[model samples]
Target: MSTFGVIARREIRLALRNRGVVITALIFAVWFPVISALGIAAGAGGDAAAVAGAIATIILPVGVFMGYLFCADAFLREKRDGTIETLLCAPVSLRRLWEGKVAGVAVPAYLTTLLSAAVTIAAVSTLSGTPVAAEPLLFLHLAAVVPVWIAAAAGLIGAAQLALGMRENQILGFVFIFGLIFLIAGLQGVVSGISPVTEAVLAAVGLALLALARFIAGKVTKERIVRTIP
Candidate 1:
């Protein structure tokens, strides 16, 4: 196996062992989609396409938030447990390590989001007695755009946690959690802007985030990470 795959597999195993992590993921994966579907369907005014679009929109942000939550456990928890130092000393380069961590978190988070999307679509289809609500564009959004954001968010969060001191990591964690909360609160307002023009905009934003993640990941070196260790 490639070094990246091996590292990612290890993190995945760790995530599975942490029952709390899996449970939290399941709750978010199921709850967010179901709730979003219900809320939009209630006011959808019989527009299945609109309900589908709303659920898709909700899933993207939720996926990004899930990535952050798991990245904390995947990356920051290692620092708390004193394992990060040992891992930093491993033969692999720091960039590879960051790739593994980001991929590890992004894969699971993205899958959970996909599960939520499926559930929401199925539930709405059943309720409305129409198989037509599963919009192709919405699914395309889930399959394409959401994963990019998940990877971007995970990469940035993991890099910061690995590079920063304990105190800064705590502050960052609070900032991220609260920042996501604020975003969720304004979700409806945000969704309105995701039209055709914003499809290109979303893609552009995703690319920018990926570029930033790569920059952050590139900055992670053994010397810097070890210096931050308490």
Candidate 2:
């Protein structure tokens, strides 16, 4: 019954009403994992669990994409539909509304990802020949942190959409593309040493840029509105 929870539920209900959104999201969450696992299992003809690890790579990009997609829709949709003004008229603070929107999408998308992972595991076990050694402990670690990463990525996109409006083409597109670059960079560093702090700092920098973009967008939008009202 908390404000965040209420707002989250409300947003979720809205998303649910859109069959396309729900179904498409479910496809992203499930398809890649299942297909990758099945392919590796069948090709290698080895342990089913081992094939699941290969599918984890698919989760990484999908997670980033989902995060951005969710956040973008959350904020941008409100603005497009004039719901933002109505929400602002309510008791919800700007920050709280933002937080609620993040949760609204992240929670459901993440749960779908989890279910997809389960399905992948089962299918791989039956269909794959690769050794499947997915440790329960490792899964726990991923589950705990992946959501945070997704939230961060989504928040950046939401902020961009809010602040940049029609001008967001370059900025939002760059950030979205940057996620892929970051992943590639990380892969390149696989053989080299990487500090935990460095990783955290990089993530912090991305979030900071997102916050700055949002602030700038707000100012620009407000100025444009004021100018038009002559």
Candidate maximizing lDDT: 1
User: All candidates' TM-scores?
Assistant: 0.88, 0.71
The sequence of per-residue lDDT tens digits that candidate 1 reaches over residues 105-169 is 88878888788778888877666654634466676677677888788778777878878888898
Among all windows of ten consecutive residues in candidate 1, which has the lowest summed lDDT? 193-202
Which residue segments of model 2 deviate by more than 4 Å?
A: 42-52, 129-134, 167-174, 177-230
Q: How accurate is candidate 2 locally (lDDT)?
A: 0.58
Superposition-based RMSD of candidate 1 using all C-alpha atoms, in angstroms? 2.5
Q: Candidate 2 lDDT, tens digit per residue, 1-230?
A: 99999988987777667677677878876777666765767664473333444545445456666666555566667666666666667786556666677678777667666666666666666675433434542264246435655666665565555555545534665666476548635752552222344334445554554465445444444343222221
Model 2, TM vs. native:
0.71
Q: Candidate 1: deviation at residue 97, Å?
A: 0.6
Residue pairs that clash (backbone atoms under 3 angstroms), model 1: none
Q: Could you tell me the lDDT of residue 191 within candidate 2? A: 21
